[model samples]
Target: MLSKVVRTIARPFDERFNLTNRLHESLLDKPVPDHARRYYFCFGGIAFFLFLTQAITGVLLTMYYVPSQDQAYSSVFYISNYVNYGWLLRSIHNWGAQLMVVFVMLHMLRVYITASYKHPREFNWVVGMLLLMTTMAFTLTGYLLPWDQKAYWGSTVTISLVEKVPFFGKSMANIIMGGDKLGQATLTRFFSAHIMVLPAGLVLFMAAHFWMVRKQGISGPL
Candidate 1:
């Protein structure tokens, strides 16, 4: 039985299609710079890991979440109070978001100070910027989903800040608020953007970012 299982696992690896070989060459064959052994050089990887953590925890939270204005707070309260490990999920999602933003910015700073965004790597910088923005949007949208006092006021303050953005300020604020005031529509829109729109943007930009990094290789040791 053991031999058969080994053969089954090994069979696909030995196929003529060269899939395993290609994957090994693309991933396992890559080398790390000696400098990457240091802690700060790990910022980018840490940021990506935090994003994955957020994605997982966010999805789990959504399963028990109620997006309606009337029940949004009650649902969150129930999860935190009643559901098994629900507080753990929310805690991970919340802190993971904060850490993700910090690490992404730290990674950006490391790249900047090291001049990693030069020459063949300039485009990856743009990809990173877009990813950073998407992460922040995820933060904002997720913040408002609970519809609690803090979340409500936080989003209101955010809209007020955007409302100061000159010509398009009021228009954007109105769109975000779902009307002249914050209401059920605001929660619904925020929940949609949180679980749907911004995540798609993150995935798209993250894929491009990783592809570019793999193609260009890591920046040289400084």
Candidate 2:
């Protein structure tokens, strides 16, 4: 079964190689069209650029952050007051996250209004929806890392909403908060989810999204 699956994957690679060779032979002398003036193309690119900025700044902030209930807030304060350019890094990360979410939403809106989600691009649209959810998850998990009163109460409200789910609501909230109540375990879990798990998932989905865009080619204006 594994061999069959490997062959299935390798077949496309073989076909791609042959197609590339043929393209090199046939289109080497052709000149591509200049579409630099188009703003739609630029919008997606700008969105991706902002996401990259968020990833970089988020990593830097992680180096100094301590997620414990006792130290989390103080550590963030230390980063802000003591570490050189820490304020700038934290500010960029916070603002960049907001900007990334906005740009991603706008990019999806553009694709939707133009009917780019039709036919072959449907899966890419689905991947994009997952990306949007992941972005919001990242924001929510990170909201509690500072361990401030606002962070604590904000998370309390959010978790209460989660606990309102019908059948498995209480259990699910317990699993998420790491116990029956929010405490050190909850902070640790949120820290890991925010910094590690969600980022990894987002990267995977983003890669798939880009691969599909390349495969189907960009949708043209209607």
Candidate 3:
């Protein structure tokens, strides 16, 4: 009965737009080689799964999070202590982010070891690198949102390192932190980047990466 209802609802769209064929081609018809079916080959999918997990939990965190230097710590405390299940959500988001970085590294290493980055797949390699960098940026920015002592000292050290980078380094660091110091401005900047800019960039790069993979298919064994 449930399946009948679904088909009935989908029938007009399927007939008018050829939805069934397109769905089959996109999802069901792709072929995978035997070697690429190995356990190690699953890293990229695991990384993507972690990314989805982080996104869902991150959105939930943002609902109760106050992104101010003054209230940030208090808000996080409230979430953990006052809001039901908020602690679990925040924990999952934090750990999922860390694991995403690990899996992305493993996926890139697998690609390099398999010689999958050569020739026509070079552009995809660049995209993967960008994705890695973006993930790092997400971690860095999110680190400061809690506005604790560790976050404070860590961001200060990072900004100091940024200032040491050759020409325009000091200026670039200022632009990112919004001043010479880590205060309310720095919190706002990091929070904005964490929730807004970095997510958009990640989505854009991920779409390109997936499209390329579908077009090129997975490369064969070494």
| TM values, all candidates | 0.91, 0.82, 0.94
Deviating ranges (above 4 Å) for candidate 2: 1-37
Best by lDDT: 3
- How would you encode candidate 1's per-residue C-alpha lDDT over 1-222 as one tens digit per residue? 998898688787779577768879878877788877778889999998998898898888988999998899999999999999998998998899999999999999999988999999999998888988898898888889888889989888988999999899999989998898899988899899988999888989989998998888888887
Candidate order (TM-score): 3, 1, 2
- Better candidate number, 1 or 2, judged by TM-score: 1
| Candidate 2 Cα deviation (angstroms), residue 220 | 1.8
lDDT of 3 by residue, 1-222 (tens): 999999999999999999989999888887788889898899999999999999899989999999987799999999999999988998999899999999999999999999999989999999999999999999999998889999999988988998999999999999988988888999998998998999999999999999999989899878
* Cα lDDT for residue 145, candidate 3: 88
lDDT per residue as tens, model 2, 115-202:
8899988899899899999989988998899899999999999999999999999999999999988899999999999888998998
Candidate 3 positional error at 82, Å: 0.9
What stretches of model 1 exceed 4 Å from their correct place? 1-19
lDDT of 2: 0.86
Backbone clash pairs for candidate 3 read none
Q: Rank the candidates by lDDT, best first.
A: 3, 1, 2
The TM-score of predicted model 1 comes to 0.91
- For residue 136, model 3's alpha carbon misses the true position, in angstroms, by 0.4
Determine which window of 10 residues in candidate 2 has minimal summed lDDT.
29-38
